[model samples]
Target: MCPSKVAEGGQRGWIVPIGGAEDKENDKRVLRRFLELCGGDGAEIAVIPTASRLNETGDRYEQIFGGMGARNVHVLDFDTRRDAHERNRVARIEQASGIFITGGNQLRLSTILGGTPVAQAIRACNAHGIPVGGTSAGAGILSEHMIAGGDSETETPRANGVRLAPGLGLTNRVVIDQHFRQRDRLGRLLAALAYNPFAIGLGVDEDTAAFIGPDNVVEVEGSGAVTVVDADGLQFSSMAQVDGDSPVCMLGVQLHILTAGASYNLVTRKASAGELSTVKE
Candidate 1:
């Protein structure tokens, strides 16, 4: 549940990747910790099943909340334009203690829910100290600037390897990419940082998460690691010819890699030492 500062004082959120969920023991642990952050109260788990390909995703969501001791779980089916779906989603977000975006095509979620009334409601949750978390596509949409998806490991320097999509922007000046190590998405994340020095690029490995607290303190959790790319001080060549899919040469960038327990201040753009130390492994 983290400390009281995260649970009751300010905005806190978590980002996770798809197919990276831990076992029941770990899931229960995370849920407990997150609930504590929501003032030790049972969180209203809102599942956006919009991205899922099948109805079973809805069922899986029910199980998730049940395991977390959250009796209030709502699934929003964005595939339908029915007022009922939209109204229900809005109501759920307004009362939710936490929101979770399920794994699937993040682009689909954004396209369907981007400007909807429900989207605004979710933002309100962030404004309130309620922690919002996502796995896979859900994690991808937490940043103001989001990585829709891209080709990794090509090394072809092709443009459009990483597609930039409008995220929910619960947090500003950041872009998040998931399944980083499993997918080797450093290049794309770096490109994103190079393109926008004002933003920090976070690549979260599968089975891992970045738990960000109200003070803008970010902690790495799970078995994997978190990578932060800071290009704010780097000098880069022009991206004029890069277009959308072309890769541009990005040199002199600084990257900080941190494992679990390490923390970084997203606001100051500085990696912390001691309890928040950055380490290779």
Candidate 2:
């Protein structure tokens, strides 16, 4: 995994990627932690709800953040690519102490914010030690390589089982998959790894999150688990030999399942537990 870029005297913000369906009302362990990392009350938090089709998604999170003591909460919503250029909106992100992105179609988020000034601001926040968090599709957009979409019903390794798309590039070390176990996305997550073996595959379960620090250690939290796939030892892949979405053969892949309190070092490619499990890749 590539080391993340640094800023502000070699400091970087925490990148928190939450799987879909995080508990907003009850418990709210994951969201609350993100707020704490952002410096809690009075922090200027920016909520990006560009991915959702629903009009209320932005307001809903705005209320949530405000209710959680972020009196200075701003809901930055945009429709077309033109909206991304709004100087006032981009400035809010640039000055935000913390940023949260809501879940929806990841493609919409990428197409609208990718390469824009607003996206550039978000990256700056992270590099400057301001926490940037996202859930579901929001989580997918934080990585350099995002899982677009593909068949989720099966676990077979296929050349075309998953699609890849460019994301915000906040993190180049990992490819994210949300609502992982619930959606049976192991196949596609592994397929993404097969296609880009250089990047690690991170499959996060519902209500959970992976808080990756500048140190590249991911601290797992919330209910359910996080699946880490390391293709560093991959010996072979039949991607070139496959045709028409056919299942492909692969070898030497490692799998590690982690839960709350467990952590994984992205730099070392090692899980909290010493033993590394093998999948049928």
Candidate 3:
């Protein structure tokens, strides 16, 4: 895993593929990792399940996180933001040492928090190394160029994924997508990279996560894996043909699959470049 240079005393973050509730084992492990990143007990943590299966999402989080040893887990119901609701949510983000986002429809998170006080608060918390993390949808929004949300089964370049209006640009020049293999999203990610070649593409698998540090190191953990598609140095054809909802032939692109015990360097935007556990593609 590509573990960043740990600060003397700072919180770390884990980007999971959809929050850890679905997988009991993964949830436990992620919770342990969160605890570790928070430096163990007394870590002020909050869980925002803003992205969930619509109805019954918030209460589900209390049940899951409460069982994970999180004593004071604050749930932010962004669906209907009252004045006091916004203030409390922003306050929690500002004071939080660790903020965890739940998995569901990322669009839900973006629509509510986009250009809002809470979005800024979330970004501020991440900037200070407060360890902002999420699974599935949460993981997808970490990149400056977020995938937002997209459709599947359509491999054409015409497929357009929503942008995070005002995403927390922790990692810039990159767009992230989750449920990679399980969902067959490589073509879509490639389409996104084709449209913006300068940006990187990361397709994370279920039950897997990428632990990133301030130093730009990303380590792969859990039973699943992460795919890194770097088109920055690729030799490709015109994106116009593909933009017409047609398939475009991509000539050269660097793709790497980083699984458990593997790591990647975000600064270099390459995998297996450091001493961390990693594999060359």
Candidate 4:
């Protein structure tokens, strides 16, 4: 577990972004780690299953967190935008020490939670030192620019291969993609970076997570690795010169593969000493 510390601006929250397919039946390491960041057994957690279509999604997490010894676990479920705006429903988020977003369709999460009271409350919760965790589609929406959906095929980088949309914007200047190596989504993540070369693209593999502290320090966890694509120093790119469907050509796009226990500074765009290993082109 990462040692907790006071973040910049005096905030004490944590942003735990897990790739999809965490082990729920066995160790439950990811969820347990989230609980630890949220103050362990004394934490009040709110589980948001808005991204999932399954009816039992919320119940499953509620039971899991309860079993983990959370002081209180409330599942926030809403069908329509109006439901997201309900005062009573939004109040639950304000009182929680931690919030967990389940996996499903990321588009559904932005559509239902966007511009609503619940979304605003969540932002406020994170701002005031409350730990927030999400997996799969839940992890996808933790950025300012989210990958809504995209082609999973390993094709040449193209503009149309991936789609981008507004997310919860819990963190700006970053884009997150989940189920990375498990789904072979490197191509899609590359395509996304082609469109927005200035933003950092993170492709998190299954069972792995990027624990981002309030101070902008990210620590890798789980069995898999986190792929960091930094296109800010790109030497060349045909993204703007070519048509929408044309293949993109980018050079000098730095790539870093961060394994468990590795640390990266999001603000400096640099990895910790000896922890940084470049992915060869």
Candidate 5:
């Protein structure tokens, strides 16, 4: 079990970006680890499913969390920007032990909740020792720059293959892409980095997750692997000169494929395949 983020009393929390279609029926190790980090037992979990249009999406998570042993699990719905400001609604976010964002349309999450107090409150919680987690579109919006859409079929990087947008401003360290290998998104992800070599590119596969620790180490979990693209030594890029439809030219890019138990240091730009030990308190 992971140490309780809430009990840390101000030890900046973690950002959990889970690839889409996690196994909710089985062990659900990813979600289970998230719950453990949230403080378990009587943990108060808040589910945000605004990105999804399906009315049952939020409620379904509420039930899932409850069944998983969360004593207080509720779905928070802020229909519009105005609803985001409601004190009662914002309070729900502020007082939560854990925050979980469900999968859907990333654009909806950006347009509706981008600048609202609800977004601010969630940020506050994470900044003050509360674990925040998301899946799929939820994962996409957890980063500072999000991959809104791109060519999923292409295996080679193209100048116009990827689209970028502002996200929740959680971390500017990495740009997240979901269903990575399963959907063949390497080309688009590489293209995204070409636009800004400063930010690293993280490609998360289905049933997998990248648990970005406060210490800047991303611990991989689940069955699939997480691809880390480090463009730190990027010598040149054709982002400005290449045609929109042409293949991009680049130099000095590093990539790492990490499976369960492996970790990557965002700050050091290094990879480690060491096993991870459970945290106990």
Candidate 6:
């Protein structure tokens, strides 16, 4: 296992990846959890709504977080890549206790924030143990390699069904898919794993979340489940071996379905059985 990234004398910040459509008005369990990890009523949060084109997207989260008792909340909005690269624009992120990214379009989030100073600042803050949370498209960009967009309802794994793109690179070895069961995204996520078998595939259902610790211990929370697809031991027909839009043939893939309170260790690739149980990879 890798050593914890928590700074000396400080608690390790969390990575909260939420599937879209979380209830902000009712229980607000997901957002509440984020606030708790971010330091409760004293939390300083940065809200990035760049994924959504709507003018009010950022405001909506600002209001939500404010009502949740965040001491300070700032919305970082950038109209262009030039604005995204401005150090002044992203300076607030460096001082924040946590950052929340809203849902809309993953491509917009990546194209605007990728390789920019703001993205760098986020990576730096996360390294220093600042919790970062995102929902829907926001959740998709938490990994180094992200599923940009895909055909959700496909029954088979098509070679070109899913689109891949560069993301925030917060987590190094997993690909995230949001609104998993709600949208029937299993096939799409499976296709992504087929293309990048070395990484674990996480399909998070709507209203659910996976809180990843600095040591890569992921604890599922909220109403739905998280589906973990491990393709490490899989035998598959190569993408190059097939022509046109044929389904990829795969074997020996391991799948685990986890609900709230269940945890998984990214380092050992094992699921915990109440007390950190170990499973064969």
What are the per-model numbers of colliding residue pairs? Answer: 14, 0, 8, 0, 0, 0
Worst 10 residues of 3 by lDDT: 13-22
Segments of candidate 4 deviating more than 4 angstroms: 1-9, 273-281
Please provide, for model 4 over 1-281, each residue's C-alpha lDDT reduced to its tens digit, 9 standing for 90 to 100.
Answer: 11233456668478788998987777787788899888889989999998999999999998898888899999999889999989888999999999999999888899999878888887778878898889999999887888988778564677677888988878876789999888888777888888768788888988888899887888888888888889889888777887667778988888889987788788899987344445455
Query: Scored by Cα lDDT, where does model 4 land?
Result: 0.84
Stretches > 4 Å off in candidate 5: 1-9, 276-281
TM-score of 1: 0.84
Give Cα-based local distance difference scores for all models: 0.69, 0.88, 0.66, 0.84, 0.88, 0.85
TM-score quality measure for candidate 4: 0.91
For each candidate in turn, give its C-alpha RMSD to the true structure in angstroms. Answer: 4.8, 4.3, 4.9, 4.8, 4.8, 4.2
User: Per-residue lDDT tens digits of candidate 2, residues 1-281?
Assistant: 22246754677889999998999998889988888888789688899999999999989888887778875888999898889988999999988999999999999999998888888888877887889999999999998988889878677778789899988888899999999999998888888888869989899999999999978899898998999989999999888788667987889999888988888999998788423233235
Candidate 4, residue 136: Cα displacement in angstroms equals 0.7
Candidate 1 structure quality by residue, lDDT tens digits, 88-113: 55887788777777778888778777
Best by lDDT: 5
Candidate 6, superposed: residue stretches over 4 Å from native: 1-12, 273-281
lDDT: the better of candidates 3 and 5: 5
What TM-score against the true fold does each predicted structure earn? 0.84, 0.94, 0.82, 0.91, 0.93, 0.91
Q: Model 3, residue 6: displacement in angstroms?
A: 16
Q: What is the TM-score (0 to 1) of candidate 6?
A: 0.91
Q: Counting only residues 3 or more apart in sequence or on different chains, how many pairs clash (N, Cα, C under 3 Å) in candidate 3? A: 8
- Alpha carbon deviation, residue 87, candidate 2 (Å): 0.7
